[model samples]
Target: MPPIAMPPGLKLAQDVMTPAEETELIALIEGSGLAYTPYDKGNTRSSTSYGWKYDYANDSFVPCKPIPEGFRTIAERAAAAAGLSCDDFAECLLNRYEPGAVIQPHLDKPVWEHVVGISLGVPTTMVFREPASGEERPVELSPRSLYVLADDARYVWQHSLPPMQGTRYSITFRTFSAEGLRRLEACPAEI
Candidate 1:
């Protein structure tokens, strides 16, 4: 991925919690397996709970975790980051990873609507870039931190957490209205 300057209204924030909070968060991810997944080492693929599929061999969004919080506070922040309020936000999925797990590089794919992500638990590095220009930038996200991707960031860029060796967590923020959910049978989301 190439490195393209972020557009206006974009904010990437890190370290949303204190060290004590980070420790507590690590306990949450390791214990919950929000990162719980089965990996095909030969193919480098894994699954969480979202029912989204991932084909690491091809670097595509196959399937993975669901938005765990159902689009709560963090969703609000993501919306805010996009210049929208909570009303414009929709769902959230928690990516929980334990030691020695790896997620391949791929974008969220267009099937879903909008997306937002926050890093939590142990720190992790996310790969990003200007999709059109092939510019790349790798960012390390800390526990309790928030990342809002919208506008050109939404359609023009690709992102992934790659592989990691320790406990790590990522909460993705997404948006779709109730009416919007009515349009998609699978999106009502049991809040």
Candidate 2:
């Protein structure tokens, strides 16, 4: 397959999902019976994890439920669009951001190679910063759009979203590294 043309390590597709599709997906997430919790520390957003949950205290993945069917469908389509293998992703994190919620700047942990995010509800600006140059680039995330971060963007640049204007949600799909896969397998609980 030809590589998807993208900016260095980032791929973005706007209007990837229709409004109705976005609404349906959001409803599915809300009704999925997953445990959505606030960041144990200080974050304002709430999130639910599938396949693996990050244990902030231990800095590792703990067993979690399998990815929901609705999320799997979206992840598969986004992976195909980004020129990635659908099976590569084994986890999904669903985040719900209320108005005034903010995400701090941080690079995704090394356990996950690629980060694919599907934006729903409302639009927001996601800012990416180069660690070496300290330069910043802001991208507007339109509702029903998809963004993928890989390579340098995944490892070198840190991304964040400012306080939001309205309630918004994002579904992020992540692929585990070899070590991460082993960790998941070694866990006693089924994921």
Candidate 3:
């Protein structure tokens, strides 16, 4: 396949975390004691939200558990790598994907703006598609690597993960958009 040019505002950094850090993050996720709920087809993708929970069933956002210290530290690094401020990140989501689990193509909620994601445990390819044009691009994500989606990449294209070779965990951080900020101000958050 021909190499696909990355869309504007999409950035990826390789080896953002050391193997030791990756191991530690995985351990922290395992010990966090947060509820992981399955929301995808066949119950293959389970996730827990921090700072704010996204109600997939209702397609709305709600306040949830605060971001854990371990994740917060990494999120800060991710924010810096993405050229964003850690303070701007208001939500964190941890997704656990079982082998062969797939995430269908879809855009994120408009309430969120920039997105930073850290990949762990397994390597996988994320395919981004332009809905109107149907043009697709595939980006491989290695364990401990980080990827950022903003601007056109965040709003114009839809992204999804194909079936994986092994269990994988993605730690995602998102910043609230103007609309999200307004909503946040109106809602009483847990933290």
Candidate 4:
């Protein structure tokens, strides 16, 4: 498939992480002891949320296990590479995609302004669809690469990952909006 045309406010950095860093990050996530849940009711991928998890049942953000320290460095680097502050993000979601797993096209919730994703283990094609025009494009995400979505890319397009041939992992970092933060603070769960 042809690679996607780059959209405004979208940035992709290939081979952003060293092999050693990737290995260490993988080990840290696997050993973190946080339970991985299905991406949704029946999605093939499993994921664990850190810092905050949206409670669909409650329609609010709730606290989850804190992000591991090992991931802090990765987040910092991603922020710096994206021209964002390290403090800009306060949550992360780590997804593990087994072979054949796929994520359907969907826009991220409006609660976050930007998203930074780090790909690991295997390369995969991420598809983006323009909401109004419905034009689709594909972007290859290589192992140890980083991709950032902000502004139009974050709010106007929908993104998805196609079924993979090998296991792959993605760490996505996001910052909560002020209203989201207020809702998080009002959640019954302790932060």
Candidate 5:
């Protein structure tokens, strides 16, 4: 295949975790006991959040269950792959995509800075689009691989996933932007 021009500040790292680690994570996620809520245009996809969740009505992130200890090592590794420290991230979103599930094209919320996603289970393609140029780039996300979106890729491009032939899971970590930090400090001590 010819080289593809990826958006600036976008990074992809393969084999971030061993197959055994991936299986352990899947087990942990399955047993987390968190309810999965519908996402995107239709109710085809579902997700659960930890550390923090965006409150659409309030336009701020609210504290949710903290990132579980079981995921600490994975999170630390993901942070290193993104050239950041684990403490830099304040939110973790777990998504479960059943066969035929899809994610509509959209940018990450403005209050977020860097976004890192670890793909697990079945492999799938993530499409990134530059709205101004009407250009779309497709990147394959293999199981256990990780991707990071920062700067232009995180702010200028919109991304989505098409319907998949098999089930997949993603663990996404996000850092707060300057504005997000302010809003986070204003959050109540208890949720």
Candidate 6:
């Protein structure tokens, strides 16, 4: 297990969950949504290319859909450890990949109580670069692990997945707003 790294304002815990927990989460997300669209992806005003995001900002987002029993249990524990109530958090932004798929680097826009993610299935490299300086840190996201980015890290540094060279499963957990939820319901995320 890798010690949680607090680089500057960033807080990263590589192995937050057990292996069994990871397997259960993958099944939960993959089985939930039949048709899927691009998530957390975008291109900025500049020429730099970015990847998709699971924008819960829209109303079409299935907030209560993907919260598998096991996942919610884990979230509760992690929240307690962090001294949070968990009730205030938003829904899970689940992302599934076959192979050779990748998400680009970008900062998480503030929307929920915290920015959370869970990794399962085949291991993947999660690279974090200092949002401004470009210094990079690569961490292997293992099964059933919780990755929490809060406070400074959520807005300060940039994190992204390398090309999904091999098939892997991941469910990114995040929080959203009632207003944003209304928007998602009305228009839904284009990505």
The candidate maximizing lDDT is 5
How many clashing pairs in candidate 5?
Answer: 0
lDDT of 3 by residue, 1-191 (tens): 76789877899999987899999998887666545465544757777778887676766678877787787678889989877888777788887788888888988888888889999999999999998999998899999999999888998989999888899988999988888777666666575
- Compared with the true structure, the alpha-carbon lDDT of candidate 3 equals 0.83
Question: Candidate 6: which stretches are off by over 4 Å?
Answer: 1-6, 14-16, 38-70, 176-191
Best by TM-score, which number? 5
Local distance difference test scores for all models: 0.56, 0.80, 0.83, 0.81, 0.86, 0.57
- Tell me which of candidates 2 and 3 scores higher on lDDT: 3
Q: Residue 166, candidate 2: how far off, in angstroms? A: 0.5
TM-score of each: 0.63, 0.88, 0.91, 0.90, 0.93, 0.68
Candidate 4 stretches with Cα past 4 Å from truth are 1-4, 34-39
Give the TM-score comparing model 2 with the true structure, all chains together: 0.88
Summarize candidate 2's per-residue lDDT along 42-160 as a digit string, tens digits: 55577788887767667667878888777767888888876787777767888888888888899987777778999998899898888789878788889999998977778888998
Q: Write the per-residue lDDT of candidate 5 for residues 44-88, one digit (tens) a residue.
A: 566778888888767777788888888899899989988899988
Task: Give candidate 5 regions above 4 Å deviation.
Answer: 38-41
- lDDT of predicted model 4: 0.81
Error of 4 at 80 (Å): 0.8
Over 127-189, each residue of candidate 1 has an lDDT whose tens digit, in order, gives: 677767787767667767877766665666666666666666665656553434444454323
lDDT order, best first, reads: 5, 3, 4, 2, 6, 1
Candidate 4 per-residue lDDT over residues 114-153, each given as its tens digit: 6899999988988888989988777888999999998777
lDDT of 2: 0.80
Give one digit per residue, the lDDT tens place, for model 6 in 1-191.
97645445444456666676666765666566533443434421111111123334452433233344656776785565455655645555556665666777878654444666666677787777785687777777776666777665676678887767565665555555454455455543433
